[model samples]
Target: MSAMTSAAPPAGARRGYPLIAAAPPLIAAVVTAAVSAAVWSRLPDRVATHVGGTGEPDGFAHPAVLVTVSVLLLAGWGAGGAWLAGTARVPARALYCGALAPAVLLGYLSPALLLANAAADQAADVRFPMWHLAVAAGAALAAAALALVLPTRPAPEGERGDGAAPRTSTLGLRPGERVVWQRTVHSWLLTALQGAMVIAAVLIAAVGGDTGAWIVLLGGAVILALTTRVRVSAGEFGLALRPALLGVPRLGVPLDRIAAAEVRPTSPLKDLGGWGYRITAGRRGFAVRSGDGLWLELTDGKQYVVVVDDARTAAALLNDLIARRSAHSEG
Candidate 1:
């Protein structure tokens, strides 16, 4: 096992996380239901439910059916958020903002759907205004902004002062010798989230006949591609991380650019905010799960971190390689 999974996070690391994350979607569902009720009389017998690429209604359903589906979807989304919160693996604020942004976007769309149908003589005549998409995007942005400003618990504190110093001469590489260290890191939380997306996609397909199901499946695929596992490689080339599922989307820090490398304990949620290819303030890196991570102090005045098993060896190897490169540059 990697050092990344050796230790558990602090108790109550996830306290109040579920409620805060789930609130937005549940509230959005209620608001959407209220709007549907207010315009119930104005809505045509058949309401425009789905639109095509042309921004025109391509599918219709009874108002009751439409509202029921919308409410159910929102409820399910909220449930998923709550479920993710229980893992205690991601930052609370991240979950809150993520939930709010999507809830607000969908909320705007639901009402726009009703208003568009209400103004039409019949469902077939309803024109799904393209501008409504812009409004939804703006509303989502506003909701995300609100999430940032709203009072919330501070990030969980990490165990500090456990950092290991760079072993610059540990390896003592021989002339013409080549050395490399590699490890693969995985995240159970990410795997579970992808599984949930797959299940949700199946449920949506069963009810909605593959209309919105593909989008959910696509999202799952994206998560799988990016967060399934990461391959960490340290050699004369310095440090590199590549998604196990894809070849092109990779990160690398050249040997010349890295000033030093060491091992340090980290909190994925607290330190880096959340996992999987993150950039925050002065430091940036991939953190699938966290414990002892390889911390790099770059020449450009920035830091990089990646959680991996046996990070000491990787760091030591990187430090040794950096020393060798520096010595060769001077000689």
Candidate 2:
């Protein structure tokens, strides 16, 4: 196939693309970290425990601890968000939520943990676990809200692709076209698994009448809802996924928003908090629904990932896109 060249960005606006694009993840990370830090620092000096007298007071900021933990949390959230923006075969919503979840968790949990520890001398109270639950609830609500906020960049003047809204015709997947198919299949598989989980969860809720089962069901529902929307489009745009309760979700992206693309098998367990759209540079990247796939590094410093049916094929397609884009730009 002939490599095509990309047209240059319009005068005065070229430089802005990089900056604008980078803002999403960077902002998400910074904001999340700040919020988390603020929450962490608010624990009660002496939390009562079941053991006995309350232990020594706890301070949220140990300066060093605050910086270290905040940095770590920020990095995790940023990587996760960018990864989703770049690859996930879905929309930025999922990734945004992904980032927000950890931030909220860190904010509330870290502090709560300290409080729990502080109160430990008094007794083996439920402070720690209860705090964890509180953190989880708050995070869930916050994530839900933020994920719905949606990240959007201007679609280039003449740009369009699979990630675009919708069409009257087929998805435009043509034979012999330079494209990635594995990710689609993998995403579909994940969708199927999520569907099964949701079904099992529903069954458990119905047959078992257990709140735990209901909670599990809800989780599966979230996954199922997330999995179905991932996809690559006829347009040259990269993978995108939009979550449920979010609009007419689909696997989509704006062609111009893409910054970079690459391929690498991840230490699913070690690098990411364990697969399913993991993100972090040193230890993370967006990965959705498991397995090896393609990695897209957006100008936003976020890694959007797609689980490819064939990694080799996905790499070839990405190389083609980069070449085409570069060529088009230089033309």
- Candidate with maximal TM-score: 1
> Model 2: per-residue lDDT, tens digit, 257-319?
565554444323433555554546633334443334455556665555554434434445554
- Which candidate leads the pack in lDDT? 1
Worst 10 residues of 1 by lDDT: 1-10
| Candidate 2 vs. true structure, TM-score | 0.34
In order of appearance, the predictions have TM-scores of 0.54, 0.34
Instruction: Please give the CA lDDT of all the candidate structures.
Output: 0.74, 0.45
Clashing pairs in 1: 2-309
Off by over 4 Å in 1: 1-158, 161-169, 207-210
RMSD of each: 8.8, 16.9
